[model samples]
Target: MNYIIIKDSQQLTEVCQKARLADVVMLDTEFVRTRTYHPQLGLIQLYDGEQLVLIDPLEIDDMQAFSELLSDTSVTKVLHACGEDLEVFQHAFGCTPTPMIDTQLMAAFLGYGLSTGFAALVNDYLSVELDKSESRADWLARPLTDKQLDYAAADVFYLLPLYQQLLEQVEVKGWLEAVEQESQLLVEKRLKQVKPEQAYLSVKGAWILKPQQLAILKIIAQWRLLEAQKRDLALNFIVKEANMVEVCRNEMTSLKEMNEAGFDHREIRRHGNTLIEMVKQGQAIAESEWPAKITRLMDNPAYKQLFKLLKDEVKLASESSGLATEFLASKKQLNQFISWVWNKDRNPEQLPDVMQGWRKEIVGEALNKKMS
Candidate 1:
């Protein structure tokens, strides 16, 4: 359990140089994002099969060497359930790790179930129980205890061995390419910019709103997201999402009106007037300029039958492909595929979650044939 804390540029350069020559490298990050739009990087765990170290993000001045090593593509990067870590790396180094493989996906391919926790994977595969005492430690705090550092070191230390085992089994299933593609999409998904204008689509009650009300919701939602970004605050901290739906639906014109409607007082007081203006602006738009009403997929008259048919097709594909139903296609992906096919707005570039790359080849073709 020995680890070097790379606090200086000289040490980072040395390890990264060696890491560049490595065939495999495992990476993990510790970050805090309780209040902000971006996760605050605390420490980075890196292991290139030989050199295991913790990169002290707080103490280092230049991270260019480590950043370059991330995108080098020659070395395969391994991580367990790496979605958030990808975000941390992207924000810090301006790129997601290249040639990356998510061992979680590897587990799924090997029938270990989807979304397996790191410690569980380690315990089951490597037969080593991970300490969970520091699971919720404030990684951003300085002078991290020996326990904390050991915990962080353990994150990357066992990843190489676990990945090696997973890779061998996944390759036997001929799913190594599939897992790699899935990992790429996972990174790409996080990298996709959130357009404020399109923000209302994800609101829970948005489908009930009329086109014009949706216009108002769109405006205010955009404002709220932009404000959150500007302030580096969480979106709900600026204006609760429910309030956005409510204000747009009820046509409130002032903070006082918002308060009367039982919206969050602090939010109404803070952005009431600004929100009022956004509503007025939305109302000013021509009727023809409003966005189309979102069609609730479940409400379609043929929805029950269509969805069941899709699921049945997925079940058949699962049996044939020797992939589990859960891993072959989740309900979310099934819904996404139906939406993409029925929505009329979907295009190839905006591919559905389960329809991208290897997924399209394995199960997507059968699903399409069933629906086509």
Candidate 2:
């Protein structure tokens, strides 16, 4: 493919200015995230039908032009499975691409299944076998290999063509707006990074812990999250959640005790003292200050039956709407809705996933009616 590699701000600015005039642009990104809190953006691919541009993020310091291009409302940006791509844009450019559509979400609406891979979509629709051998390439490395370039280019090159098909089908089914909203939700989700203090709520086995134990877990989780964010390291690379729970429950005091418990030596060495300190801080927390006890959804005596009814309603909605059940609502979203309804604290604010956006007009309203 004949593509321009934008290594300088001027080239990027020129290209983005030209792309802004285009009705639609294809977008994708290559990044490394192993052991990191945020994705290390390596490459960005763009195709505006006229020009194919590979943006070398490491080389280009000023990304203002690209940021403006993403934020441009008139020009629609097309992407495939854009959840992670949005993360890169949000972190690097501090903006989400406006007027976007995710081909993956589009596929789900068309009954292609939620988990369809880009390779499969290309092969099935465009009759192109994507070279994915370089999918795991170290994008952060300099002098990207020919295979890596080929792999990266293929990601955005055929997206417009695939999008054309998706757009046509979605429009015919009157689901274009739905797909757009779903894409925006992906962007919003990236911006909703978990706060450090609340990180313990996401840890496994946290629900069963007593309030005082939760206090310890909360402090430890907060410390881990802050440490990870500060160091740009993955949470588990610092200390596993299971280990945190065990340490809190057993009340291990010394580094020697943690080592004897088979804790990872590197983690013990790096964060052992901090972890011990966090336990002490947590124990000092008063009863009023302890985090609220977590109520596991599955613990409800009527959970299975209620879940089955909701799922059955989803099946009916799917058949009626000619959409995938998974597309309508995932198990987690359903659980969220159940939780929101069950909690006495439930109100209009921070509605469950199913009860938001286009879903409200489709299945969410009916689900609410059923719950009522």
Candidate 3:
């Protein structure tokens, strides 16, 4: 395999120009982000048939040319599980690749099980085994080892053939449009960042909290998010949600109380005072000023019944299709569907927008059948 290490913007631009002439470009990125909410991009690997180029973002200042190439409508970007990689590009280069094809999603759509890891896919489709041992290698380390380079090259090298195989399967299955639509939406979705205030909605314990506690959790979560971004560290490193929930429920104010509960003092030592202040501020807020009460979906019997039916439908569809149910629809989407079904005021005509494309074709029919 001919590998080109892109050390600066000029090389990156030239390589991208060469890649743009190709019909499809196999793309993969090596990033480290265990320390922060956002990933730190270390190496970007691109392959266009003849050459594999590895771009060192640390040395490259002007990524505009590469960004434009990514956004080029003429070329297709082939990747496996590229959502996070797309997010990295959007964050760093201010653009997301257009006309992208995610093999992970395509695999599922083509009746391959969901959440298929890269190594497994390569082994299955290309019959070429990959080394998973170096998955956690420090990409930021200087003087890349031969093994690391081989691993990186392997990612894009087999991707070209895999993409072709998946594309053929999708076309033969008459799901090319559906898969393409989903892939485009994935790129669009990755470009937008969720607001910090709405971040609390995703916390596992939010549903159990009372309105006031939910409000306080929201504020504290937002503060913690900002702090993490500023310090460039993981959110859990600052304060795990489990610990935060405990603090909120117990109303712990002092570091001594927090430590007594088995919370690591060393981790929170620097942010301890700020965390305390946040808690104090949360406690001081008027009860009426808290967020509106969140109604529990499971409380409604009809909704619960619909939720059960949806799960069964998903299971049946997944089994018949040879895809994973979790990949087809998430538990959150199940809940949302239940709510949508129970809401008499929601027009079925508008349902397509909320639940569109392949999902509509697969589960929508069953939903309509049940509702009717």
Model number with the top lDDT: 2
lDDT of 3 by residue, 1-372 (tens): 778788988788888888889989999999887777778888898999977988888888898888988889999998999989987887788777788889998898866766788888888988888887777899888887989988898899888998888889889988788888889878876776668888777766767777777767878888878777788878898788888877777666888888888888675686667767877888888988887656678877677677777788888878776667876777866766656666634456745422677777777677667666
Please list the C-alpha lDDT of all candidates, in the order they appear.
Answer: 0.87, 0.89, 0.80
Per-residue CA lDDT of model 1 for 52-166, tens digit only, reads 9999999999999999999999999998888888888988889989989999988888777787799999999899999978978999898999999999999999998899888
RMSD of each: 1.7, 1.4, 2.6
Q: Give stretches of model 1 more than 4 Å off.
A: 345-355
lDDT per residue (tens digit) for residues 1-372 in model 2: 788788999999999999999999999999999989889999999999989989999999899999999999999999888888888888888888898888999998888898899999999999999878888889999999888887888898899899998789889998888887788888877689898879999999888788888999988888889888899988898899888988888777799989998999997998889888888888899999988888888988999999998999998899998888988988988998998899844578979878888888779988888888
lDDT (C-alpha) at residue 40 in model 1: 82
> Comparing candidate 2 with candidate 3, which one achieves the higher TM-score?
2
Ranking by TM-score: 2, 1, 3
Residue pairs clashing in model 2 are none
Off by over 4 Å in 2: 344-346
Q: What is candidate 1's CA lDDT for residue 114? A: 83
Q: In model 3, what is the error at residue 359, expressed in angstroms? A: 1.7
